[model samples]
Target: MGNTDKFEMIANIYDTSERIQIAKASSDAIREYLVEANSKNAIDFGCGTGLVGMNLLNDFNSMLFLDTSQNMINQIKQKISDFNIQNADTLCFDFEKEGLSDLRADYIFMAQVLLHISDVELVLSKLFDVLNEGGHLLIVDFDKNEKVVSDIVHNGFNQAKLTDIMTKIGYRNIQSKTFYNGSKIFMGHDASMFILDSQK
Candidate 1:
């Protein structure tokens, strides 16, 4: 499926997805990055159904919930079911399309969504452009996506390559860590995170 289709599809079920629930370690990661976020302003790129956004509602001052799928954004609205979303706004966008100017944010977040991009260079470059001075970005997903999912998904920016691309974009404090047992067995949904801090 294309990026737009991801959320339209995920939006239907992401509230329960293992990735977005803010696990203990995952929540710790988010808190650490966001504490340095400096501003409550945030942008959630490819925020399918806002599942990740829901976890972060308390973290941001105002949120520009962005996705390529209008249907997905609509699904987010449907999924959230009327929380006090006054501080929330939605935008239809594709990272490769390069129109990231609706609003700038101190923080940019992508969760369970980064690997679905084919053009990390363009997207990260644009993200760097849109970031406020001393901003940060937190991206969370599997270092290894499922084979079936990968076959149909467009997840090209794997961890090592992604770290390289973000560094090329001048994003600082780049770190990547993988989480899994020594067995290397798939536990259905495992935890892995890449946290990037924008020094621009």
Candidate 2:
């Protein structure tokens, strides 16, 4: 199967775990990075199944959830239905594409999505462009040393590479730390968090 096909096949399983306690904590950490933002508009890029949206629904006044896979967005639509979403919408978007040219947001978020695309710098540039001045970007994914995902399709990337990419992209005072808790992606026996937060 192709990359998207594989994700589509497994998307249901991902949505089913949306409210799990551990996942809630994981999502909370990422959301905390944005809660204090000056603006209420936020975009969750690569918002697969809207897990990030589910965690953040109560915080943002408006949110745009974007993903490349239509099936995954469908899964998110269903999964987030139970939440009290004040304002939320989903779109099929590839960040660097022309269609997203005018889509600027006060805050841009990406988690569990970067490793899928190899053009890390290009993707970051797109996110940077969409942010309002003084906006922030929060990212949570696997660190480079997490070898369990080495052979997996579109797994998290190395921590150092992320640091370099963010600095080169003109991000400021980037901060990152590893979270050693287990993750279902690694069969619940892996350290799953290395978070990065940067400014535009």
Candidate 3:
């Protein structure tokens, strides 16, 4: 099955898995660099089951959880009703097929989403276009690791190269830092994850 189908199959169990714990850690790391006051509207791209974005509900006035899997979006919608999250909503959108040309946000948060993308540069450019001026783009993904091999997902990313790409796409004040290291995380190998923060 494709990645979206795979995610759809896992949608029900996602929040109870170890991946959710890792996502919580990723969200905690994002909190350190996030300026809560500056984020009025945020988009959680590739938000599967809303693990990270749900925890960040207090930070933004409104949040849009976008994902390719309808099953995933269903889980997020359930959570929204369960928690009475009036400011949170969800959309099943595949950025690779349908672009975010009309949609905009004050902050765009992508956690562990970049590696699954086939065209990173194109998506980054689209994200830049969607962000308002002075808006922030927070990306959380695994660092470059040759130990992990995958035909579907990327092997991860090089910080310098990713920064360069963001810069070329008109993103400024770029900063990246390796925040989390987990054993047997990526493809059953030890991997380190980094957070890249930039402005549009």
Candidate 4:
């Protein structure tokens, strides 16, 4: 099954897994790097079950939870209602297919999302297009690990290589740092995760 389909099937149990702890760590890192003035509007691209975005609702004036799985979006919507989160909303969008030309945000975040995408450059280009000038793009994903294998997902990313891609895509002030190390997080293998902070 495709990653979207898999996520759709698992949406009910996704938030209950150990992955939610990782999302919490990612959200904490994002909070640390976020510029106070640039936190007006944010988009949590590939936001699954709103784990990370839900933790950051108070940081942004408005939050858009975008994902490909309808089930995932539904979970986020349910959370919004349950918490009475007025400034948060959800969108079921597959940027890989529909594109992001109509969207704009002051900050865009992707946690454990890029590795699943088949065309990283295409997604990065579209993210650049959607972000307002000087907006920030915060990405948290695993560092390169050959031990983690997957047919549907990229093994992970190299910080230097990712920085080069972001620079070529018109992002500035590119900076990345490995922030977490978890056992059996990726394909049952231990892996480290890095957070990339860049500006448009």
Candidate 5:
């Protein structure tokens, strides 16, 4: 089954306090590197249940919450309706199999989404195409953790290697730092989360 299928089953129960806390932290990290967000359109790529994107709605003029699972999109849509969020929208999309659409954004942020992508370079390239010139791409994901091996997801990522990959994909001004360290955060093992900021 695809990752979307796995996430579909958990969409209704995805917003536990732990996840909310993590999303808040990730949003805070992204906020630190943000520039002129109020004038920019942003995309919360792979946004699940709108946890992080919902918290960041006020920062951007408009926010697009994109995810692969329709159920997750439904959950986010419900939250949008319940909160009367006027500046946010939702799209159920899969970057892996789909060609680049007309979608474009001034800022693109992905929280804990890179680990699930099997072809990281392809997705990054597609995201690059989706970004407006000089747009920023912020990625929040776990640092390398050798102890946490899995078949469906990466153990974590090496910041330097990731920067190299992003650089190759044509992203500039790449900067990354570990911002949150939590116990049992990655595959039931202690892991540190890093935020990467890159410009297109």
Candidate 6:
């Protein structure tokens, strides 16, 4: 989960075509479940280079692009300046090391982020606390894949198991479904992605 240096090193070249396409798909999936978002604040949790958040600027009142890597945050800052986006800000914070400090949001979404966390339940609980009442948490990630194996990240996640974990964390009205499938999407193997929506 401590891949801060790894991400920082690639921050400049992270927005490749494949990643951009995935981010686009993720954002579209998130938009489907977003409700009354025009006047709400959002946090793009673990927002890498602001790919997903950038596409969602017009959907929310304000967006906070948050990442653990300063270089990643810098990349987003450059984008924010280049696009003249006024309602977006960047933050460099690590939830696993330091809990979200009074940072609350009406909506929080993470794309392909939960796979990297070592303690998923703890992080989910922290996010739950950070969300405002009646807010939503949207997660876009790879569905369970048995073909891929890795020590640094999970192969994928079982939707039912994840829902159970979120329910235990006090999230309600949980729902999930597969949305996108692509080649070499996860660990060089063809995989499908799912979007899960939960309310606080």
Residue 138, model 3: Cα distance from true site in angstroms: 0.4
| TM-score of each model, in listed order | 0.77, 0.83, 0.96, 0.97, 0.98, 0.98
Q: What is the lDDT of candidate 5?
A: 0.93
Each model's C-alpha lDDT?
0.65, 0.71, 0.88, 0.90, 0.93, 0.94
Clashes of 6: 0
Clashes of each: 2, 2, 0, 0, 0, 0
lDDT by residue (tens digit), candidate 4, 14-122: 8765878998899999898888833489999999898999889889999999999999999998989988889988899888887656789999999999999998988
Across residues 48-117, which tens digit of lDDT does each residue of candidate 3 receive?
8888898787888899999999999999989889888889889899888867668999889999899989
- Deviation in angstroms for 182 in model 5? 0.2
List candidate 3 stretches off by more than 4 Å: 36-39
lDDT by residue (93-196, candidate 5, tens digit) is 88999876799999999999999999999999999999999999999999999999789998889999999999999999999999999988888899999999
Flag clash pairs in model 6.
none
Q: Evaluate residue 109 in candidate 3 and report its C-alpha lDDT on the 0 to 100 scale.
A: 92
* lDDT by residue (tens digit), candidate 1, 1-200: 14565556655655553444344345455666567443468887777777667667777778888888888788766645566566778888777865747568888877656567765577778888888877877776655544324444443237777778788888887766553222221243332444444455
Candidates sorted by lDDT, best first: 6, 5, 4, 3, 2, 1
Most lDDT-accurate candidate? 6
Better of 3 and 6 by TM-score: 6
Better of 1 and 6 by lDDT: 6
Write down the TM-score for model 5: 0.98
Residues 22-131 of candidate 2: C-alpha lDDT, one tens digit per residue: 45766677765765653478888887777766677667778888887788888777755755455888888665454456887877777666766666788888788888
Error of 1 at 195 (Å): 4.3
Off by over 4 Å in 4: 37-39
Worst lDDT window (10 residues) for model 6?
1-10
